[model samples]
Target: MSSLSMDKIVELQAWKLKELLKWREYLGVLVEAVKEVFNDRVEVYVFGSAVNGRLTVSSDIDIAIVLSEVPKSGLERARLVDKIWSVMENKGVPWWYPFEIHLLRREELSLLREAKFTRLL
Candidate 1:
């Protein structure tokens, strides 16, 4: 094989992730649950150490939830959290994979560093 061809192959295969991440599939399931809370105004992101191209097998998936509109009051936020958690539990999201959740209002995003997230919306 030519050296040039090998380089091309390497470039083409760079984005490929070989692991059978059940967590990724589970994310697909959980997105629906979160959407119910915001009525289609939510976005999900895979952030933190997990998606940084340097993840160890033990790295945790840091999920960031962005809502189009934030709750107006503390009580509303609590109720929304309760509902979202209930939905997550009902979905049987396999806890086998380590993860954490970070919720953010749409406007709050302006304060976050851009390189920190990989949008899954």
Candidate 2:
């Protein structure tokens, strides 16, 4: 993963929103894949620029998944991410957009609320 500066992150967020609107159907498919992967163990949100209606043609997807339980290791998280990616690809959905997975425990509602961001999807 590449490190993104605050400004770059903000810009990317806005661009992602544009792409979401342009490809709403594909976004739905991605969301469905997330649901299938995590089941009731997590809540997936479409956050950042895409939700705020400030996206551009090059925006990437920023998805935040609040998990009921944290994975045992980073590898587990990576595997889950790969599974979601695979499902989207199998469905013939575009994978051009990047994903930002934000894992949170069920008890972290307060933290999530304190975070400054928008939920678009």
Candidate 3:
């Protein structure tokens, strides 16, 4: 497995701490929901401003989900997204806000490139 330097890990931890303070409850629920739905098929990460410690109350959540495979149809993925969104909304966790869900395939070239970049840099 690739390893990140202590400095980078510390930076990432600090960023996550700050984000947790803002959206702890919501995120906890979201994480649980994701785990329940995707099981072992997906991995989730927080990125963008939240990952960089530059988040504001107005800043929307940026979640990156890596899946073992890209669904053959966009509708399939959209359904998953909608299910998550509905759950979040029903849980009263601030729906109708701007947020981004980035889905990536585990075997995609872009993902491979990012892994290489992280390992090399």
Candidate 4:
């Protein structure tokens, strides 16, 4: 903590507070967004720095989305990933830094590692 400048500390606190206050609201927005394309077969989670309370204002939001229905082929998976990516990459997103969205299928839960994920939907 000593190494961090006062301004940086203040920035981190503000960012943490913003996330704390809006996390549920943000998750609701995420649910609505995912439901538009994914229907009820998806789960959205907040993970990484945000989940662990180490986020700075500039730290990216890390997310993991798990689809209930797994695509059968590599091409299909790629397309699914692309579709979800497009949804996440929409320009109107509110965060200061771009989010890292990990799109996976139920069978790929093993892909999540070291991330402390909190499921929102």
lDDT of each: 0.68, 0.68, 0.63, 0.67
lDDT (Cα, tens digit) per residue for candidate 1, span 83-121:
766777778864343556667887777655754777777
What are the runs in model 2 whose C-alpha is more than 4 Å off?
1-23, 109-121
**What are the per-model numbers of colliding residue pairs?**
0, 7, 0, 0
lDDT of each residue in 11-120, candidate 3, tens digit only: 87687556545654566667666766676667666666655666664576677677787688889989888777777777675665445666678665364343311110
Clashing pairs in 4: none
lDDT (tens digit, per residue) of candidate 2 on 14-114: 86665556655666777777887876756666655666666665665566777778787989888988888889888876666555666667676556564
**What TM-score does each of the candidates earn?**
0.61, 0.65, 0.62, 0.58
Among all windows of ten consecutive residues in candidate 3, which has the lowest summed lDDT? 112-121
Instruction: Give the CA lDDT, 0 to 100, for residue 116 in model 3.
Output: 19
Regions of candidate 4 where Cα sits further than 4 Å from its true position: 1-25, 69-92, 95-97
**TM-score quality measure for candidate 4:** 0.58
Off by over 4 Å in 3: 1-21, 56-58, 108-121
The local lDDT score (0 to 100) that residue 87 gets in candidate 1 is 79
lDDT of 4 by residue, 2-33 (tens): 65687888887796667654544556556656
- Winner on TM-score (1 vs 4): 1
